[model samples]
Target: MSIWICRACGAHSESRSGPPPKCSICDDERQFVPEGGQEWIARETLASTHSNDWTELEPNLISIGVSPAIGIGQRALLVLSSHGNVLWDCVPVLDRKTRDRILELGGIKAICLSHPHFYTGMVEWSEALGGVPILLPQADLVYVTRTSEHIRPWLGDRYEVLPGITLHRLGGHFEGSCVLEWEAGAEQNGALLVGDTIQVVPAKGWVSFMYSFPNLIPLPAREVRRIASRVADIRFDRIYGAWKEKVISSKARESVARSAERYIRRLES
Candidate 1:
């Protein structure tokens, strides 16, 4: 038996003789199965062809992504702090080189995911790093496909995973969709490691909230407002999106407010 990973969404499944009949995560309304149909890959297969690529986005933040674009093509952000390193999101492929590099820069102390879409190979990652605790929102616990002892389900609107790094649930994409507020990031101006909960649009200094990004489904106006309101008081100067180069470097707090107002206005119109 081998741990199978969904090719479409990168979610891991239990050890099995072969690929599961279907992928629940991709079959859901928010995600979709490709026209080519559902597919699965073994952990060893992924390691053979793909490799982890690391880039330093800032002094204490590192962007880790997979080459050849495994799964949903999302990159994980490694936030370094005096307390410990926290992996904001996760990728499907983890190889020996990547594991060694992470160890050199101080092994991960905790792993917190923004949502289920990025839950790819999280258990494997935690095991590789000597059983780091995986902090997931309690509301989204149902989405976890592969169970592990390292998984820690947290409740409520906010959780301080570390001393200065906090996870704030905004609830746009999923019930437990959250963002990491690095209080000491962006040169003390603060930074937000936001996944798809609040999407950074192509236009600079702008973001959008959605229920389904790939399906083009818009979130309710009230829900969008609520998400914005949740982070209204959090002072953050930078906003990092799920993909590479999608960032609001400065005035990110204002960007969220402005974007929310714009989204609401368009809805009312």
Candidate 2:
């Protein structure tokens, strides 16, 4: 069956023919089914049903719409070079308009997700774009539902999918959590797109670590140090986060280093 959105929690799934507004995870979350009642959108329905407004935030980055009032809270960094063009993270919906827009920019070289939740419609995205591969760190493979021959796996700290783009596994939030490092990264005005593996504190334009569990768990100070070290080796002066408010300018790399080190020092002190 084609994919559909759960009316209750907005989860996208191909599990049609089940009970109305069916979603076990949302049920467990204690989020009730929608009062408007159950509704479904087929995979093909996106062509007409969903319209993505892609706004270019930088040279090779765009924030695709995640909601009328919010973007995916994840930014997609497009890598363009003699090697190829790639989208660093995946988002939930992809209609023909978006697909065509992305294709016009040299098509997608590959699709990579920083972690499980960000997997979004990656497989569907790949399929719609003529089977562009989905590169996921093997450590987070269990979270992927849409597996394809086009889905590639990276088993270690870093993988180079394209010439200028690299994915670095920082391992704080999720064991396989990552950030994209463009060869010409933020400094080139291209931006380093971090999808909350290290998050921005909008109040101060700094980065911090998070433990994998969402129940307010905190990442250990040493783990934060390690993440900082991993990211430090890469060169990116600018940084852009998923949504509009979570971004910082060309000095983000320096800020991230200082913030991470400050966090580590505080814990040791």
Candidate 3:
């Protein structure tokens, strides 16, 4: 038995067999446990609530897409690589169609998350991908509701999901926040798959560049510089933020540098 997030109530439940037994507090109208009755989601059962529609986002660097949770607030990115495919972040939803699509794109090799909030369907996803390794930052392991042999707790400033793909933790939103630097994003340099760690404000045209997109709170100039410094070491030509327009097509490094300086100047001034 593992902890599963209730789609309706958003509460973590120690799921053992046959749907969540009416989500303790909320009732059926609120959530539906998986049919197997033995379906397990996370290692911790106390965790609750989840969203469906693990809606797959678009893929390009290697035929990947963002798995979306309609009402819930979270995002998952799918990355297809020859060595093995990886799903970055994670939405609350997961279904057969998406599974079929994942199979078509090549079964997932691993799922690396940026933080705990995005760890929604982690266990379910890991199981769906034939026990694909779910790489988590050791620091955030406390939030893991579902414990699995498949869950590989790793520590450090960065993690290698697969060949040409690396997960770099540049603390921001969460202590273990990370961004993916994919060598395969393109042949030239690479692409940074940043969930919301460094948001792309499509509405602003410029990358929103924030500590927290949800809160609209800005990071200190020092923090901004740190993020920029961490990312600067990596060779990337583009930055993929979490939306349609959250990408910077201009000189990638230069763009980050400018954004960093601008943030610092504004904060200081």
Q: Kindly list the per-residue Cα lDDT of model 3 for residues 1-269, writing each as its tens digit.
A: 55555553233455557455444423322233345442334434322332234333334443223333332344566777678788887755566667777888788888887656566667777787688888888887766655678988788998877878999988776677888888867454687788777766544434535554444677777888888889789988777665445677646667777767877888899
* C-alpha lDDT values of all predictions: 0.92, 0.69, 0.65
Better of 1 and 2 by lDDT: 1
lDDT of 2 by residue, 138-254 (tens): 887765544568888888898887777888888887788888877665546446778788788766668777774344567898899888888878777777665567787767888
Report residue 139 deviation for candidate 2 (angstroms).
0.3
> What lDDT would candidate 3 get against the real structure?
0.65
What TM-score would you give candidate 3 relative to the actual structure? Answer: 0.75
Ranking of models by lDDT: 1, 2, 3
Superposed model 3: Cα runs more than 4 Å off: 1-69, 72-74, 203-205, 209-211
- Candidate 1 lDDT, 59-108, residue by residue in tens: 99999999999789999999989888999999998888889988998999
Alpha-carbon TM-score of each model against the true structure: 0.98, 0.83, 0.75
Candidate 2 weakest ten by summed lDDT? 24-33
Error of 3 at 227 (Å): 0.9
Q: Please report the candidate that would top lDDT against the real structure.
A: 1
Q: 1 or 3: which has the higher lDDT?
A: 1
Q: Which segments of candidate 1 are over 4 A away from where they belong? A: none
Please list the Cα RMSD from the true structure of every candidate, rounded to 1 decimal place: 0.9, 3.7, 7.2
Colliding pairs, model 2: 73-242, 74-242, 75-242
